[model samples]
Target: MYINLHNMQAIIALACGVLILIMPKLLNYIVALYLIILGVMGIVRF
Candidate 1:
């Protein structure tokens, strides 16, 4: 499949959602890491 930005983002979001549901405590870290990675990706245009 031709994976694109939206698809990748959706996958990341889904993974994070699952993690949050599982831990319920690492939510802050998960979200922070997600945003950081996303920000880096955006800056790199990846």
Candidate 2:
């Protein structure tokens, strides 16, 4: 049961997209956080 953070983030981002379609309020924070995390991960080569 060794789940990586990147995989977890992707899953969360996907879920957030679905939630955003329903609520729409989560678009900003969820997408922002996902991009920030993915950017950091790309820069850090993780």
Candidate 3:
């Protein structure tokens, strides 16, 4: 499968944002992890 990791990460981030609205506790970890992962993906070009 030709899956795009960047797009996948974006989708995950979007989902996390929606989830965060329901559960504010996840805001820190989810957004932090998503940003870190997305940053790495962008820098490394994966």
Judged by lDDT against the true structure, how good is candidate 3?
A: 0.82
lDDT tens per residue, model 1, 1-46: 9998899989989998998899999899998898899899889985
lDDT of 1 at 30: 92
Candidates in order, TM-scores: namely 0.83, 0.58, 0.59
Q: What is the C-alpha RMSD of each candidate to the true structure, in Å?
A: 1.6, 2.6, 2.7
List model 2 lDDT by residue over 1-46, tens digit each.
6779867876786899799999899788877887897799899995
lDDT of 1: 0.91
lDDT of each: 0.91, 0.84, 0.82
The candidate scoring highest on lDDT is 1
Off by over 4 Å in 3: 1-10
Worst 10 residues of 3 by lDDT: 1-10
* Candidate 1 residue pairs in backbone clash: none
Worst 10 residues of 2 by lDDT: 1-10
